[model samples]
Target chain A: MANAVLTVRGIVRSFGAFRAVDEVNLDIIEGEIHALIGPNGAGKTTFFNLLTGSLPLTEGEIRLRGEVISGLPMDEIARRGIVRSYQISSIFPDFTALANVRFALQRKRGANFDFWRSERSLESLHGRALELLDELGLVEWADVRAGDLPYGRKRALEIATTLALDPQILLLDEPTSGMGREDIGRVVDLIRKVSKGRTVVMVEHNLSVVEGLCNNVTVLARGRVIASGSYKDVASNEKVVEAYLGAAHA
Target chain B: MAGTAFLKTTRTAGVSQSQFLGFTKARAIFFLLFAALIAVGPQFLYPIFLIKVYCFIIFACGYNLLLGYTGLMSFGHAAFFGMGAYLCGYAATQWGLPFELSVLAGTVIAAAMGLVFGWIAIRRTGLYFAMITLALAQMVYFIAMQAPFTGGENGIQSIPRGTVLGFIDLSSNTTLYWVISVIVLAAVAFYNRIIHSPFGQVLRAVRNNPERAKSLGYNVDRFKLAAFTISAAMAGFAASLKTITFGIATLTDVSYVISTEVVLINLVGGIGTIFGPVVGSFFILSLEHFLAPYGPWVLLIQGIVFTVFVLLFRQGIVGELQKRFRTHL
Candidate 1:
C-alpha cells in the first residue's frame, strides 16, 4: 500500500432512518487516481460530500495527513488544501473563464486583504493562471463568459476552478458527466495531466474511462462497498459479477 | 501537486481577467476630475447645496457597494445612515467633541451596528435578506423616533457645526462645503480602492456563486460581514458630515423615505459604475431644488422620474453614457 494522503475510517453518514453512507473506510494515496464507482443513489456523492466536509459524518474519523478533518467547515477544509468539484458545474457564470479561475488563485495567494494595492502587481499569479488555461486547452476561450461556454467547457472550467485552489487532494464528483466522446477524451487527457503527482479521487461512471485511468477502483451498491480492487480483480470477482455484470450478462 | 498548482493558477487568471474588465485607469481619471470639481465647486455653487449633494452621493455609493458588486440587496441601509447622523448630531451637541472626532465616532458606531445587523440578516439570502434588514431598520427608525437624545418627533435640532481642525470656523457655508468635499473625495477613493482590490473579486465571486466560492476555500461569511461593515461606515460618514454641514439632524435622516431615495439615486445613475452616484446625486438634488416651488408636485415629478428610470432606463444615465461610449470604464 502506498502512503495515504487522506484516510477515511469507519465513516457513517445518515439522514433520519436512512443510512446515506454506511460505515465506510477508504484510503487515497499520493499521486494515485482512485476511482469511486457506483450506480445512481448508491451514496457515491454523499460520500464525496462527507469527504469534502460539506456534510457531517455520523461516526468516523477522516484524516488529511493524519490530521482529523471529519467535520471542519468546507472553507476551512479547502484552506487546508482539500477541495472538491461538483457534479453540476458551479462557477462564476457572469465572470470570464479566466476570472473564475483568478478568484480562487487570489484566495490562495493572500492578495485579498490589502485594499490599497493594485492586484495587477500579482504577476506570478497571472502567469501561472495563463499557464493552467493553456494546459486545459482553454487558452482560446479564456475571455469567454463561463456561462456562455458549452456544457463540456463549463465542466472543464469547473475543474479548472478547482485546480486553481492548489488542493493537495481533489475530490471530483462526476468530472465528465455530460461530456461527448470528443470532450470526454479531451477531459480525460486534461485530468491525467492535472492529476500528475497529486491524489485524485473521482466518482466516474464511464467504465472504459475508469478502466483506462484509475489505478484502483472502489465499487458501491445500496450504500455499502460491494467490491474494491484493481479493475481486473473487481471485474472478475463473483460477487461483483453477480452484483453488476451478471445483470448485463444475463 | 500538478492538479493543485493547476487549480491555483486558473483561479488567479479568472480574478485577473475580471479586474481588467471593470477596473481601468480611465475610471480613475474620471473620479479624480470629478473630485477636483467637487473640491473647487463651492467657489461658485452654493456650499450648502453642494454639501447636501455630497452627503447623498456618499449614501448612494455606500448602498451600491453591497447591491452592485456584492449582489446583496439591503433595504435597511437607511438605518446605518440615520444612526450615523444621530450619533454625530448628539455627540457634537451634547458631548462637545471635536468635529472630525464626532464624525469618526459616528462611523465607528454605524460599523458596529452593521456588524450586528449583518450577523443576523446574512443568515437569509436574496429577498429574505432584504426583508430582514428592512425590518431591522424599521425597528431602528422607531427607536430613533422615541429615543430621548434623538428628541423624539422633533429630532436633534440646532446641532453645532464645530470648528474644523479646531481653527477654521465651519460656520461659514463655504468652509463646511470644503470639509464635506474633502471627506466625500476620500470616501469615493476608498470605495474605488475596495472594489478594485482582490477583496472585491471575492465579493463578486460570492455574488456570482457563493457555494462555489466556499468550496474553493473562501470564508464567504467574513467577506460579507466586512463589506457590510465598510458600507455602513461610509454611509455613517456621509450622514455625520451632513449633520455637521446642516447644523441639524432629524428623523428625516433615518426614515424609510431616505433609504428609498438613496436607492433611487443609484438606480438613476448606475449601480456598478464608480462615478454614477456622484452624477446621480447632482441630477436628483438639482431636480428636487428646482421643483421645490411646486411643493407636492416635486414629489410627483420625482415619482415620475423614478418610474421612468426603473421601467425604461435600468442602466441609468452614466450607464447609458458608458454604453454609448463603448468604454468599460
Candidate 2:
C-alpha cells in the first residue's frame, strides 16, 4: 500500500454518553480519493470535525505527515497544510469570487498580517487567484458576489477557494451534497481534476459518486468502521450492505 | 443576499476607480474640502466646538474600525476614551508633562486596555461579546471613580495645555485648533490606509465569515485583537486631545451614555462606510450645538433626529451619498 498521508488512530468523540465517534481509525493514502461513507448519524461529520481540529477529540490522535495535530486550533491545523470545505458550502458571500480566492491566496502567501501594503499592490496574488477561478470555470463569475451565485456554483467557488490554500490534504464534507445531476457531474469532474496531486478525504452521502471517484472506501456504522477497502470490495461486503439497509429500514 | 444586492447597487453607482493612498478621488475631494473648512472654520464657528467635533470624529472613526469593518460591536469603548482623557489629564497636571508626552502615555495605556479587553471579549461573539465589553467598561468606570490618580468623582481637572515641542505655545486657541486639525486629518488618513490594505481585506473576510477565514489559515482571533488594540489606541488619542483642548477630564467622558452616543453616531453616519463617522460626528455635534440653548429639550430633539435618521436614512449621510454617487466617500 502507498504511504498514508493522513493517519487517524483510535479517534473517539463523545457528547456526554452519546459517543458520537467511537474508536475510529483511518489511514488515507497519498494522492488517493478516500471515501468515508456511513448511514445517517453515523458520526461522520463529528469525525471530520475532529480531524480538522474544529472539535476537540475525546480520545485518540490524528497525524498528518507523521506529526501529531489532534489538539491544535483550526487555523493552526490549516496552516500545516490541512484545509477543509464545509458541508453547508462555506464562502465569503459578500466578497466577489475573485476576492474570495484572493483571500485564500493571501493566506497561502503568509500575507494575512500585511496591514501596511495596499491590497492592489498584491497583483501577483490577483493573477494567481484569477487562474484558480478560471481553472474552476468560475472566471466569468469572478466579479460576482459569492452570495448571489447559484447553489452549485457556490459549492464550486468554495472548492476553488480551498484550492487557493495549496493544501496537502483536502477534507471535503459532502462537496456535492445538494447538487443536481449535472452539477454533481461537474463537481465530480472538478474533484477528479483537482485531486490529482493531493490526498482527498471526503465524507459523502452519494454512493455513485463514491463508487465512481473514490479509489478506496471506508464504511462507518454507528461510529465504527464496518468496512475498508477498494470500492468493489467494500460495496459487496455483507456488513456494509446490512448497515445501509438497516439504516434505511430504521 | 440583501448585502450582495446593496453592494451591487452601491458599487455600480459611479464609484471612482482611481485611488491615491487608498482614498478614491471622491474621498480625496471630501478630505480636501474638510481641510479647507478646518482652515477657515474658527472665523465662522466656535473653535472649541470644532475641536469637540474633531475629537468625536476620531472617536467614531476608531469605533467604526471595530464595529463597522470587523463586525465586532463593542459596548465598552468609553473605557478607552475616558481612560485616555483621565490618564493624559493626570499626567499633564500631576507630573507636569508636555502635551505630546501625555498624549503618548494615554494612547499606550489605551492600547494596553484594548489588548486585555479584546483578549477576553474575543473569546465570545455577538451579543455575548458586546455584553462582556460593556461589563469591562463599567468595571473601568468604577475604577476611575475610585482611583486616586483619576481625582475620583471630580476627575483630573485644569490640565495644562503646555508647549508643543519645546517652544510652540498652545495657550492660543487658534494654535491648538491648527494642531488638532493636523493630528485629526493625519489620523483619518492613516485609518484610510488601514482599511484599504491587505490586512483590511482579511478583516472584512473575518467579518463576512470567520469560520471560512479560519479554514483559510488566518488566525482570526489575533487579527481581531490587532484591530481592537489599534481602535482603542485611536480612541485614546482622541480622548487625550479632548482633555488637552478642554483642560479637564470628567466622569461624563467615561460613562455608558458616551458609549451609546458613539454607537448612535456611527449608526447614523453609516456604520461601515469610511466617511460615515466623520459625517455623523459633524451632524450630531451640530445638532447638539444648535439645540444647547433649549436646556433638557436638547436631548428630546436629539432623540427625535436619531429616530428620523434610523427610519429614513438607514445608511447615514455619507453612505447615502456613496450609494447615490457610486463613490466610496
Candidate 3:
C-alpha cells in the first residue's frame, strides 16, 4: 500500500441540526487520482471545505503526513503543502494571467511581507510564473487580464493557480464542472499530465470523467461513503447504484 | 495552468487585448505630474488657496487608502485628520517645536491612534464598521470641543505659520505655499509608491476576498492593521502641513463635514485609482471656490454630483475612463 498523504477519520460537519458531512473516513494515498463522486448536495463541497480548512470539522481528525491540521487556518494548511482549487475560479480578475500566477509563485517563494525590494525585481519568481503559464498553455495569454477570460479558460487558470503552490497533495472541487466538450477533453489531458507523482483528490459528478480520470473512486451518498474502490469494483456495487447511479443506470 | 491561459486568450479575444493601464507607469506619471503642477502652480494661483487645496487632497488620499485599497469605508476619517491638526497645532504653538518636528509628532500620534481605533473598528464589518468609525470620530470631535487647550469655540487662533527651520519667514503666502506643496507632493508620491508595491497588491487581494487571500498563505488581519497605520500617519502628515499653511487648527478639522468631504472627493475622482484623490480634490476645491458667494449652493451642488455619480458612474471618473480606454493597471 502506498503511504497515505492525507487521512480523514470520522469527520462530521453539521449546519445546526442538518449534517452536511456525516462521519466520513477517507485516506487519499500519494500519487493517485482519487475521485469523490456523488449526487448533487451529497455534501461534496462541504467535505472539500473541511479538508481544505475553509470550514472547521465538527468531530473528526484530519492529518496531513500524520500531522493534525484541523485547527490551523486555511493559509497555514496551504503553506504546509496541501492546497485546494476553488470551483468558482477565485482569482485576481484585474491582474494579468502572468501576474496571477506570479502572485501564487510569490507566496511559494516566500518573503512577500518585505517592504523594501521592488516586486518586479523578483526575477526568479517571475520566471517560474512564466514557466508555469507555459506549461498550462497560457503563455500566449500571459499578459491578458484573468477576468476577461472565458469560463473554460478561467477554470483552467484556477487549476494552474493551485499548481503554483507546488503542493504535495491537491484537493480539487469540480475541476471540469463547467466546460464544453472540447474543453472537457483538454482539461482531462491537462489533469492527466499534471497528476503524475502528485496526490489528487477531486469531487466530480461526470461519470465518464470519473471512469476515465480517476484511478480510485469513492461514492458519496447523502454525506456518507456508500462504496469505494477501483472504478470497476464500485460500478457493480448495488447500494451505490441505487443511491448515486440511478440516473446513470437509467 | 494551461486552463488559465486558454481562458485568458479566449477572454481577451472577445475584447480588445491591448494592455490596460499599467499601474506602475500610471503611478509614476501621476506623482510626477502633480509634483510639476504643484511646484509651478503657486506662481500663477493664490498661494494660500493652493495650500488649502494641498491639505484637503492629502486628507482625501489618506481616506482613499482605507476605502479604496482595504475596502473599508471609514465615515470618521476626519477624526484622525482633525486629531493630527490639533496635535501639530498645539505642539507648534504651545511647545515651540519646529514645524517639521511637530508634523512628525502629529503623524506618529495619529498612527498610534489608528492602531487602537483600527483594532476596535476592524472587529466589525460593512455598515457596522462605518458606524463604529463615525462614532469614534464623534468622540474625538466632542473632546476637541471641550478641551481647554483646543481653544473650545474660537479654536487655536492666530497660530503662527512659524519660521520654517526657524530661519526663512513663511509669513509670505508664496513661501508657505511652496512648503505646503512640497509636503503634499511628497505624501502623494509616497502613497503612489505604496500602492504600486507588492504590499499594495496583497492589500487589493485581501480587499477582494479576505478568506481566499488568507487561504493563499497571507495573514489578512496583519495587512489590515498595517494599512490602517500607514493611512492614519499620512493623514496626520497632511494635517500638520495644513496647520503650517493656515496658521490655525480648529474643531473644523475634526468635524463630520471634513470626513464626508474626503469620502465625496474619493467618490468623485475614483476610489481605487491613484489619480482619483488628486482629481477629485481639484474638482471639489474648485467647486467650493466657485460657489464661495453662493453659500449653501456648494453643498447642493456637491450633493447633486454625489448622487449622480453614485447612481450613474459606479467606477468613478478615472475608473470609467480606464474602462472606456481599456487600460490595465
Candidate 4:
C-alpha cells in the first residue's frame, strides 16, 4: 500500500453534550481515491470538516504526512495543500465560470494587500483557468455567470475551481450529490481523471460511484467506522451491511 | 479558460469590461470633455457649491467601496469622515501645519481607526457587522461632542485653506476650487483603479462566498480588513478636503445624520456602479439646495423619491443603466 498521506487519530468534535464527530480514526493513503460512506448523521461530513480544519478537533489530532495540522485555520490548511469541495455546490455566483477559476488561481500568486496597484497580474492566470474549465467540460459555460449555469455545469465549475488550487490532497464532499445519473457518471470520470498523482478522500452517499471509482471503501455509522477495506470486502462485511440496510434487512 | 463560447456573450468585440466603468477611445474622450466641464464648473456655477458636491461625491464613493463592492454595510462611516475633518482642522488651525501634512495626518489616523474597527467588526457578519459599526461610530460621535479641542458645539472655525507649495493663495475661490478639483479627480481615479485591480477581484470573491474563498487558500478576514482600511482612509481624505476648503470643521460633519446621508447618496445613485455615488451626490445635494424654497415639503418630496427607489429601482439609476446597456459603468 502507498504511504499514509493523512492520519487521523481519535479526533472528537463535541457541541455541548452531543458528539457530532467522536473518536474518529482514519488513514488516508497517498495516490489513492478513498470513499467514506455512511448513513445520515454518521459523522462523515463532520469528519471531513475536521480534516479540512473547518471545525476544531476537541480531543484528537490530524497529521499531514505525520506532521500535525488539526488546529490550523481552514485557509492555512488549504495553503498547506489540503483543499476541499463543499457538499453543496459552492462557487462565486456573481462571477463568471472563468472568473471563478481565476479567483481560485489567486492562491498561486500571493493575494497581497495592494489596492493601489492594478490587478494586471491576474490577467496572467487566465490561460490556466480556461484550461481547467475545458478539462471540466465547462468551456461552453465559461462566460456565463456561475449563478446562471445549469446545476450540473455549476457543479462542474466548482470542481474546476477546486482543481485550480492544485492541491496535493483533495477532499470532495459528495461531488456527485444532487447530480442527475448522467452527470454523476461524468463527475465520476472527472474525479478519476483528476485523482491521478494525488490523494483523494471523498464522503460519497452513492455506493455505485464509490465502487466504481474508489480504491478503498470505509464505512461509517453513528460517528464510528464499522468497516474499511476493498469495496468487495466492505460490501460483504456483516456490520457494514447491517448499518447500511438496518438489522432486519441484514 | 473561461469557456470561450459563453465568454463571448459577456464580453463582445471592442468592449472592454471591468468592475467599474469600462470605456473605448470615443467614450474616453467624451469623459475627458466631461471632466473639463466639471473643472470649469466654477465659471458658470458657485465654486464652493461645486466643491461641496464633489467632496460629498468622494465620501459616498468611499462608503460604497465597503458596502457595494465588498458587501459590507457600515452605518458608522461618519466616524472616519468626521474624525478626518476634526484632525485636519486641528492640524491646520491649532498646530499650523501645512495643508498636505494635515490631510495626510487625517487619512492615516482614520485608516488606523479602520484597522481597529474592521478587526472588531469583521468578526461578525451582516446585521451584526452593521450594528457593531453603528455602535462604534456613536461612541466617536459622543467623543466629538465632549472633546475639548473640538470647540464643544461650535466646532473649529476659520481653518485657513493655506497656500499650495507655499506660493499660490488658496484664499481665491477659483484657485482653491481648481486645486481641490485636481486632488478630488486624482482620488476618484485612484478609486477607479482600486475596484478594477486584482485586490478588488479577491475582495469580490470574499464578498461572494467567503467560505469558498477561505477554502481556496485566501485569508478572507485579511482581505476584508484591507478593503475596510482603504475605504476608511478615502473617507477621511474626502472629509479633510472639505474641511480645508470650507474653512470650518463642524459637529455636523461627525453626526449620525451625515452617516445616513452618505447611505442615501449611494442608494439613489447606484450602489456598486462606477458613477453611482458620484451622480447620487450631485443629484441629492442639488435636491436639498434648489428645493429649499418649498419649505418642509422638500423633505416630503425627498421621502417620496427614496421610497420609490427602494421599491422599484433597487439597483439605483446607474446599476439599472449598466444592466440594460450591458456596459461596465
Candidate 5:
C-alpha cells in the first residue's frame, strides 16, 4: 500500500468574521489522485490556497512527507514540491509556450539567477523543455506565443509548465474547468497520464473527471469536509447531496 | 527548420525557435552606424549636447528595465540619478578619488540605497509602489537641499573631469565627448545583454504574471528587487558619467522634474524595445535643445509633443516600428 505523502491536520483559515475553511483534514496517499470537490462558493480553492501557502493558515499545520510545511512561504512550499496551477489559467501570456515551460525548467535548477549569461547559453535545457511540452501533447504549440494560443492549448501549456518542475506533489485547481466536451476528455487523460508517479490533489467540479481519474474523493461544503471516500461513496453521501442541492431539493 | 531560418532574421520573440540574444545582422549594422556617428558627431554637432543625449539614453534604458521589463513603475528615479551626480562630483572634487573609482562609488552607493528602498516599496504594488519610490526620492531631494557637502541650492560646481586612467587628458571637449560616447554605447550594449539574458526572461515572466512566477517556485520579490537594484545602479552610472562630462552636480538633476523627463523619454521612444530609449532620448533632448531660445515655453511645447505622441503614436517611435515591420528593434 502507498503511504500518506501529505497529511492535513485540522487546518482552518478565516477572513475576519467568515470562516472560509474550517478544520479540514485529509491524508493524500502517495501516487493516488485525490479530488477536493465542492460546489461554487465552497472553500475548495481557499483550501488549496492554504495548502500551497498562497494564503496564511489561521490554525493547524500541514505535513509534507511528515515534515511541517504549513508556515513556509509560497515559493518555499512550491520548491519543497507542492506546485499548483491556478483555477484561472496562469500562464505567462507574453512568452512563447516554449519559454513558459523553459521558465519553470530554469527555476528547478536555480538558473534563473543567471543575469550575465545569455538565455541561449541554456540550450542544454531545450531538449528537456521540449520533452515536457511534448509530454502534455504541446510540442506542436511549442513555438507559438502562449497568449495567442486557443483556450484548450493554453491550459495544456500551463500543465506543461507545471510538470516542468517535476513536482513531488501536484495541486491542480480545476484543471478541466471551463472547457468543452472534447477538451475536457483530453485534459482528463492528460491528468491521468501525469498522475502515474506522483500524488495529484485537484479541486474539481466535474464529477466525471473525479470518477474517471481520482482514487480518493473529499467533498467540501461550507468550508467543512462533508464526505471522504471513493467516488461512488461520495456521490451517494446524503450530506454531500444536501450541500449541493440544499435542504428542500435533497 | 528550413522555413524557420527567415525567423532568425527577425528580432522580436516571434516564431523564432531561438531566444532573443540581443544581436543580429541589423543590430550589428545599427551599432556600427552608431559608432561611426559618435566618432564624427563631435566634428559637426555640439559636443556637450551629444554627451547629454548619451547620458539620458543610458539613464532611460536602465529605468526601462524596471518599468518595461519588470512592470515596476518607480516615479522617483531621479534620486539615484542625482545621488550619482552628487557623490561622483564630491568624490572627484574633494576626496581626490580617481574618476573611475568615483563613478563606482556613485553607482554602488545608489544601488545600495535601491536595495533598501526596494525592500520597503516592493511591499506595495502599482501606484502605491510608485508613490513610495517618489516619497523616497523627495526625501533624497530634501537631503540634497540641506546637505552641506552638496552645496545646497548652489550645488557642486566645477568638478574636475580628472583624466581617464590619470594618463589621458579630458580637458578637451572633443576628447571628453569620445570618452563619454564610448561608455554610453557600452552601457547600451550591456542593457541589451540584460534584457536577453536568462534573468531577463524571468523578469519578463514576473512582469507577465508575478503570481504564476511565484507558483512556479520563484521568490517573485527577489527578482523585482534585483531588477530594481540593477536599474538604480545603471541610473547612477549614467549620472556619474554626466557629472564628470558636464563638470557639475545640481539640485535640478535629482529633482522630481528630471524623474518625469526620463519617463517621457521612455514613453516617447518605446518602453521595452532595445533602442527605444536611445531614439526617445535623442528626440526629446534635441527638441528641448531646439526650443531653448523660447525660454519658459519649453515645458508647454514639450507637453504638446508628449500629448500628441500619447494620442496618435501611443507605441512611441520604435515600438510602433517594431510592430508594423514585425521586426525586433
Candidate 6:
C-alpha cells in the first residue's frame, strides 16, 4: 500500500435493491497490471465503473496519488490522469484512426478550445498520434475509419486513443472481449507492451491473459471481493474456486 | 505535347493553395463563383426575394450548427430568431439606435437566451431535448403575443431603416441589398471557419460519441452549450437582418411554424454540409415565391415535396451531391 498510486476503499454501488458492487477495497501500485476477474453477474464491470467515476458510488472513497476523486465527473477524473476505455470498442467510428488518436492528444495538449485556428494547424499533434498508432501496430490503419477496422484492430485503436491521454492510471474494461483467439493474443501483447511505466487496472475475463500479463489479480463474486493476491494465490483460493472456477467448469 | 504540358503547368500554377482560411483550392474557387453569383443576383432576381432567401439561409446555417454538426435537433430555434427580430425592432424604434447597434442588441439578447435555454435543455438528449426546446419556444411565443412593446397580435410594424454607421442611407433597395449580401457572406465565412476549427472537431467528436468525448476529458455538456449559444446568436443575427429588410417584426417569425420551416430547410439542403442550408434556402424560398398564387395548394405542394425529399433524398440535395462527388461540399 505504501507505493499505491490508486486506492479504493469501501466502494459500494447499489442499484435500488441490488448491490451491484458491495464494499470493495483495492490498492493498485505504480507500474502494475492488476486484473479484476469475476463470473458473469459478479459485479466486475460495476466495480470498474465505480473506479472510473462512470457511476456514482453509494459509499466509498477513491484516491489517486492521495487525492480524493470519488465524486468527480468522468472527464475531471480523466483529467486527473485516471482514463478508462469501455468494454465494447469505444473509438469514434466516423473518425479516421489517426483522428481518433489526435482528438485525445488535442485534449492532452489543451487545444480543444482553439475554435478560430484551422484544424490543419493542429498537424503538430498528428506526429504524436501517428506515433501512438505505430506503437499499437495501427499505422497501416491510420487513415481508415475506426468503425471500418476489423474487430481486433478496433480494440487496438481504442487502446491507442487511451494511450494518447498519457494517463498515470488506465482502467480497461474487457479490452479483449469478443476478439478471436489470434486477436486476443495480439491484444494481450499490446496491453503488456503499453503498461510499461504506467498503472493499469483491467477487467479481464481470460484467465490465461491474466496469468500471463497481470502482476496481481482480484476475484469478485456476488458483488464482493472474495480473493486478492498473485494469480496463483487467488486462482487456488478455495472460495474463488467454489464461486467462479467451479461454476465455469460446471 | 509541349503546348499541352504548358497548359497543365499554368493550370497548376494558377491553382491557389488549399490553406486559404481552411478552404481547399476547389472550395475557394467555388466560393469565388458563389460570391460572383451574390454580386450579380439582385440584378436578375427579385431583390426582395433574394433578401428573404439570404435571411433564411443564415437562420438554417445557425440551426445546422446544433442539429447537423452537434447532433442536437432543437425545435425551438424560432425563439432565438424571433427574439432577434423583436429586440432589433424595439431597439431601432424605441431607442432610435443605428442599424448596426440594433442588430448587435438583437444578437446579444438571443445569445443570452441560448445560454439559459441551453443550460436547462442540454441536461436531456434526443426527443426530450427537442421537446424542451419546443416548450421553451412556445413560452417565448406567448411572451411575444402579450408583450406591449411587441405590439401584441399586430406585431412591431413599419420599423425604420436606420442608416448604417450613421451614413449609407439604407432607404435605397440596392444599397440595402449590398449591405445584407456582405453581412450574409461574412457570416457564412465565419461559419466555415468554425466548422474547420479545433472546436468544431471536438463538437463533431461529441456528436459522434458523447461518452467517448467525455472519457477523453472534454466536458461534453459545456461544448454542447457553447454550440447552442453560437447557433442561437447566428439565428438572432438572421432575424434582425430580416426585420431591417422588411421594416417589420411579426409574430409569424417567432411562431412554431417558423421553427419547423428552418428544420425543413436544413433537411432539404443537407444537414451537415457547409452549403446545404444555402441550397435549401434558395429551393424553399423559390418554391414559396413561385407557388404564392396557388393559395392553399402551396401547403399541399410543400408537404409533398418534403415527403419526396425525405423518402428519396434523405441526405438532401447537397448531401447527395457531396456523396456522388466524393467531396466535402
- TM-score order of candidates, top first: 5, 6, 4, 2, 3, 1
Ranking by DockQ: 4, 5, 2, 1, 6, 3
- State the lDDT of candidate 6 residue by residue for A181-209, as single tens digits: 87788778878887898999999888999
Show model 6 residue runs off by greater than 4 Å: A180-186, A247-250, B1-17
Q: lDDT per prediction?
A: 0.83, 0.87, 0.80, 0.85, 0.87, 0.87
Each model's DockQ score: 0.41, 0.46, 0.30, 0.57, 0.54, 0.36
Among these predictions, the greatest DockQ belongs to 4
Model 5 lDDT per residue over B1-329, tens place = 32233333332333234332356555555667777888888788799999999999999999999999999999999999999899999999999888899999889978998898899999899999999999999999999999999999989999998889888888898888888987988888888888878889889999999999988889999999999999999889999999998889999988999899999999999888778898899899998998899998999989998998899988899888888877777
Every candidate's CA RMSD: 4.0, 4.1, 4.1, 2.8, 2.8, 5.0
> Per-residue lDDT of B1-329 in model 1, one digit per residue for the tens?
33444554445433334442235656756777786788678677777888899898888888878888888888898899999999998999899898988999888889999999999988888999989999999999999988898888888888888887889898887777777777788778777767777777788788888888889988888889888888888889889988888778888888888878888888898988787888889999989887888888988989999999989889899888889987644
Score residue B166 of candidate 4 by CA lDDT.
90
Worst 10 residues of 1 chain B by lDDT: B13-22
Tell me each candidate's i-RMS in Å. 5.4, 6.8, 5.8, 3.8, 4.2, 9.8
Docking class of 1: acceptable
Q: Please write out the lDDT profile of model 3 over residues B1-329, one tens digit for every residue.
A: 44543453344212233322323454555567777888788678777777888888887877787799989988887777888888888888889888778888788878888898899988888899999989998999999999998898888766677777789788888778777777777677667656756777677778877876776778777788788888888778788888777878899988999889888899999999877888888888889997899999888999999999899987788788778866632
lDDT of 4 by residue, B53-162 (tens): 88998888788888888989998889999999999999999899998899888888889999999999999999999999999999999999999988879999999998
The docking quality of candidate 1, as DockQ, is 0.41
What is the clash count for each candidate, in the order shown?
14, 2, 12, 4, 0, 0
Write one digit per residue (lDDT tens) for candidate 1, span A1-38: 35988988998988999998888888888888999987
A55: Cα error in model 6, Å = 1.3
Over 4 Å off, model 2: A180-182, A247-250, B1-17, B310-312
Return the DockQ of model 5: 0.54
Error of 2 at B262 (Å): 1.0
Please list the residue runs of candidate 5 whose C-alpha ends up more than 4 Å from where it truly belongs after superposition. Answer: B1-22
Candidate 5 Cα lDDT to native:
0.87
Which of 4 and 6 is the better model by TM-score? 6
